[model samples]
Target: MQEQKRPQFKVFNTPELLETILLHLDNRTLLVSAQRVCQTWTVLVQTSPAIQEALFFQSQEHKWHAESISSPIYNPLLVQAFRPFFPSVHEYPPIHNNTNENATEFQAEAEHHGRDEDSHFSFKALDMLSSPQKKTAYMRKEASWRKMLLRQPPVYGGVTIFKMHHNMGGDSCRSYEVQEETPQANQENKESDDDHKMLKMGHFFTAFIHNEDLYFGRFGHTRIYWSTYVPPYESDLDGRAGGSYPPQGGSYSRKVIENFAREIVRSEVVAFSREVTQCCVGGKTNLTQEESLRKEILEAESDDRV
Candidate 1:
């Protein structure tokens, strides 16, 4: 007998009930793509801020957690890595993704730890992002990333690609590209006639958020050049940026990635909130602090407590 067909979930269930179901379902790719097929779904999804955040904010509640600093962007960055095995980009569309809610222990580990980018990594990181148009790009442990990165759409126009680029224009917002120095490069810098920069590469990117254009490849971890946001983030405090990142540890690569990832995500969210404001030519953005001129509003909570 033909399986009894049922009404679409949206048609049968109320919005709140539907959202509760969406919250439990681990099928993000299918759900996200489905939102595009109908006005009802599109509105239901876009209006639900919780669902929007859930896409990027992997959580234990959803049975997903940060097993590695690289987990967040691993999907997109590893697309090139999985290309050779899959062979065709068209094969990895959003619809046919097999998302088992009951993922195996090792499978979850791979997803959290970046779908094996570390295993097949040729150098310290993975290889370059061979353009999708080019045939036979190097993929990490063929078919490994496919589990996590269900869909590999083109860079610019694909709806599934992480938001193409943030466009909050002004002098305050600044994009950064920080390359980690190898041991040889570190020694070379020390021997140079100029001052020595440590295992710690000198911080280059800084801004008061509202001041300029922003384009640090948040997810571009193509082993060729991994971009990083060097920190103690610049805040209202002078010279010192706001949040202090953990010190560079040759052994603790995971720690370094995790700290920077949090800071990067937080900074991106702030810029989107319109919190970044203007300043004069020689002035700084003072971004982390909100705009508050009133004395009571500006003072510390400890002042009231005391």
Candidate 2:
């Protein structure tokens, strides 16, 4: 009986079996914990195409046919990490966070949502935006986000940027939406005779990482203000505020910057900003003529802030 002892079979030691097991894990766990288990697990996580797509490092090409209203999931890590920059109505209530006008309403709504200010997700978002000290670390060349997609389905339409301007009279928004023209259109204009092209998500990432100042717009009760500058954007159709964003004179020209900004404000306007901009002034969805003008200005301004 003493000589009858048998060797133990280790299931995880098998790479094929282990990869199958790991494929079941959520993205956060794979990145945070499983990858650290051992070198084998790490390699599997990094090399597995399915796992890579799950982490949003690679596009889910097969899922393209299945794309529905919510078929493709938003990159959860990006949603959490860049939460402030990508505001949401369900997550961040449309409230004047920096003001006290709707204190009671905002408090009640926040409580209803069970908003946990101390949560790690909230902390990360706040820390990224408010803490300049950590920017250097995040800006590293090897940062995980450098290769990550902004959206899991991958934004093939390209990225749009908006800049919002703040002022006493009223806020205004401008975008380089006009810059994303087709080759035929570009040929027709001929004004933009260079190799200037539309900015993509990768371009946004490059610009964001290199930039020192973080420019975001606040959708207040009645207005959208790009907190970068205290002045209004240039009124000219192609004019841009010096040192505003999308950075002028390089791959992203003034025209490209303008068009991108416009696209973000209209199509991808922050949910929190949109709701607050609509309801904050009077808590009314119906806008008066004056309020309507303010909303219009705010929408335009929202793009600049992007």
Please give each candidate's TM-score.
0.25, 0.47
* Model 2 misplaced regions, further than 4 Å: 1-10, 64-71, 89-124, 129-136, 164-173, 177-306
Candidate 2 lDDT, 26-62, residue by residue in tens: 8789876998888888888899888887887777655
* Total clashes for model 1: 18
Among these predictions, the greatest lDDT belongs to 2
Residue-level error in angstroms, candidate 2, position 266: 8.1
List per-prediction Cα lDDT, in the order shown: 0.28, 0.44
**What total of clashing residue pairs does each candidate reach?**
18, 26
Superposed by TM-score, candidate 2 places the C-alpha of residue 157 at a distance from the truth, in angstroms, of 4.6
Lowest summed lDDT window (length 10), candidate 2: 222-231
TM-score of 1: 0.25
| Residue lDDT tens for model 1, 41-157 | 667665675654344222122233334322223233333433322211212111122223222332334345553343211211213223422212222223222223222111111
Model 2: how far is 271 from its true place, Å? 12
Q: After superposition, how far is residue 202 of candidate 2 from its true place, in Å?
A: 6.1
